[model samples]
Target: MKTTTAFPQASRSRSGWLIAISLLLLLAMALISLGVGPVSIPLETVWQWVLQRESQESLSEFTILSSLRLPRVVASLWIGAALATAGVGFQCLFRNPLADPYVIGASSGAALGVATSVVVGGTWSVAGFNPTSMFAMMGAIATVGLVFVIGSSRRGTSSLTLLLAGVAVSSLANALVSLLMFVHDGQKTMVILNWLLGSLASSNWQTLPAVLVLSTAGMFWLWMMARQLDAYSLGDIASQSLGLDLFRLRLSVVLAASLATAAAVSTAGVIGFVGLIAPQIARLLVGTRHTLLIPMSALLGASITLIADAAARTVVAPAELPVGILTAMLGCPFFLGLLLRRPRTYSRPGRRGG
Candidate 1:
């Protein structure tokens, strides 16, 4: 028989080239995003504007580039990174490829919180207490706590239980949000709708610091746990054999994921699927190794959101569509394809790969 070593070597070489090309594509997309908008600007002008060089341009163009576009781009980058990190964390914790950040009801909780803040506080509270972000964070934390409690059994926590509880809590939260909408004053309904649909339009230097801090802290924390995450992918027995404390590992992953997600939702108001889709894309590219997987997901996530945000701005011109809508429009088909490919099975170390 002819030796096949050359084929394997060529395959590895091809995969390396593919990864390098994907990184280049991500960079190109990000640059393209900065260039396209309602008032189109050349890539060179956009680059100069980004570098703070004075262009012989109208004041409006300068303001649009610096004040509006820059903030949106930054927000999209961090938000996408946060969501993707959370998605990878959750999927690993549950050992379910289908698990996402919203699988634990964080989005619905944040939505309920935002709705309450806008409807109740905006209408009833006296001047000086805008609690929208506060309520949003509280709601997300509470929902995650509730899901964890419901999911844990006398023996331990089950991923299936966690998922089911999350669905229940999310459904209940959604119902409450609908009830609030029904009773909400006509004037505030638009505000509520916009909040749920999500946007980067409101981002500014004032709001940027919190997102930067939270996302940075969360991403760093997740990166630290990447090894433990890889161990867990081999299942509980495998993790224990590898010297990991299963409960502690799971707890840390869940908390880090929840905190990152809550921060993003509180800041930007429920942008979806950046988490779900980004990690999946990363897995397809890099396999299940968390060290490479986490960073790759962050890059992919940032790229996807940047492109989607650019489309949202240009597609509707002055009106502007929400970023969440664009992500859903793109993610749903890919998600379904993943589901149809195979039913994934979990396995422990020393067992045959399922």
Candidate 2:
């Protein structure tokens, strides 16, 4: 994790205009997703439906779209955005381009927590927050904290240590999840397995608001720290000299990332790759400043998930694939391609000017 190679410099995000275009693309993708479901609705009809002025068409499609697809799509959007934003924070905190929300085992820990909750068979709520989410968040925080502790036990936590610790923790969490599934009944086993695989199937109006609150709060916190994150990219000492409380900033960023990630997993059961890939795509377009990277990542993440969800339902028709599966299919190759090409370029990190 120690090195002399300088971090790659990106053009600073000088204007917000490009980000505006990303928002527009997100809107277009949402509409397209609405029309591309199992029961396809015409683009014109969907457009009218969205506009809310009465159309001379049947209401069944609208009902299906609203009651079912709407919440599902909204869940995907929230989870995607949250995860992608989390990824940005982690990348900066760890000073590693490949760092992601799951890189520190947050997703696996959240899944394990939910699986335990299901087996425990108690539906507790705190201030209207469901126990599932509460437990998931706790697990994610605990896991990330553990990884952080172990990774930093020897020295200032290096990216290699953090990543290695994360892999170990992730493996342990998945093992525990498997153990829980095996001890349970067939019905419970199926539920656990499905949740682990990830889907937006469980999302509904009842659960949407919780995710919204978490996403809003977490993203806001991260955005507010964007400048500190940019400073961290200049290396830890330089960031500290810039009046950043490096320890507190790193802790806050990690916690924020964990909170968003846990909420997404709680709502949609560990949808993968949105966190890992979206930020990279955003960086390519909007450069590396966290202010620009965060929003752009969120938009791209939401759009990718919507498109993936659309394909998930229609690809096998009646036998729908999990959205997580689709993400893996897409992400694995993209990730490997990143590794395969210019392998050393991204890992190099050092100080840079604001």
Candidate 3:
């Protein structure tokens, strides 16, 4: 017993250090991102701006850093973390390797809500935030609830059934979105289309707090229930025998992940595959325990989002590409490669050998 306990304790300690190192790496990447772009400020200048100290840089540079760049970066960090954390929860909940917030159609639902707001006499903003964000949240929650209703029965949500339900619902949402786009004129059509592509260009200081708070709350809840999520990887019978309330635990996690994904979509416009790739990478590095997986995944997620957004903004020079496009470009190929590499592993699985 002592020997068995010692290994996990030692592994946990190692995982903690890995998280710390990853955090430092993430900070370095963020700082590098701040310095990158058309203006090409020095890293020292970026650091100086970060310290709230005056820099000798031009006023335009100052404005870009303070007003334009910082908020978008912060938003990316939060959104990445939120998406990744949701991926962890959904993966654990469904016990399916392919499960993700977007995979389950939560994002599609959110997109439909935003589309409705935009198409029906334009979107409204309160303070600085648009009505589309609120609509997206409601849409995501509704979609997730509908999925559970369709996929679950007296026994509870079946993982395979839930996946199928998500696909069916997603197709329906896309059809509705297409119908709305067709009804609108060219201008509104372009706007809706741009939104669907996903970008962080609209992020600002005023609305960042709401997304941050929602995502943080979700992460906190997942972190608080880490052990329960881990226990869930075991068969339901085993989990129940160990005194885990399968129903309540499943409900709470699904809600938390949906809320987080909604907040992210509202801010960032449906960036996909961060949730999937980040967790898989973290699990590869640190193994299966949720406590370690959650934070580690968040770090990698933020890093990946940061890099993708940097490319999105700079790759096209003055004309920016949507961050979502960049993520999809990177992730789609990686996903394909993963599938080709491990067809058998994915097909014959025991909780992904959790």
Question: Which candidate should be chosen as best, given TM-score against the real structure?
Answer: 3
Cα lDDT over the full model 1: 0.80
Per-residue lDDT tens digits for candidate 2, residues 1-354, read 122237643344232677888788888888878877678888887777788756456488888778888888888888999999998998887777767888889988888888888788777677545777677777887898898899778856666787789899999999999899888899988877787778887677777887889887888899988878889889877877888786678668877888888788877777888888898888877778787789889998888888888888889977788999999898889867866763244765564444
lDDT of 3 by residue, 29-94 (tens): 988898776567788778777776784645567788888888988989989998999999999988
Which residue pairs in candidate 3 have backbone atoms (N, alpha carbon, C) closer than 3 angstroms, thus clashing?
A: none
lDDT of all predictions: 0.80, 0.81, 0.84
For every model shown, what is its TM-score relative to the native structure? 0.86, 0.86, 0.91
Segments of candidate 1 deviating more than 4 angstroms: 1-24, 122-130, 153-155, 337-354
Candidate 3: C-alpha lDDT? 0.84
Model 2 clashing residue pairs (backbone): none
The window of 10 residues in a row where model 3 has the poorest summed lDDT is 1-10
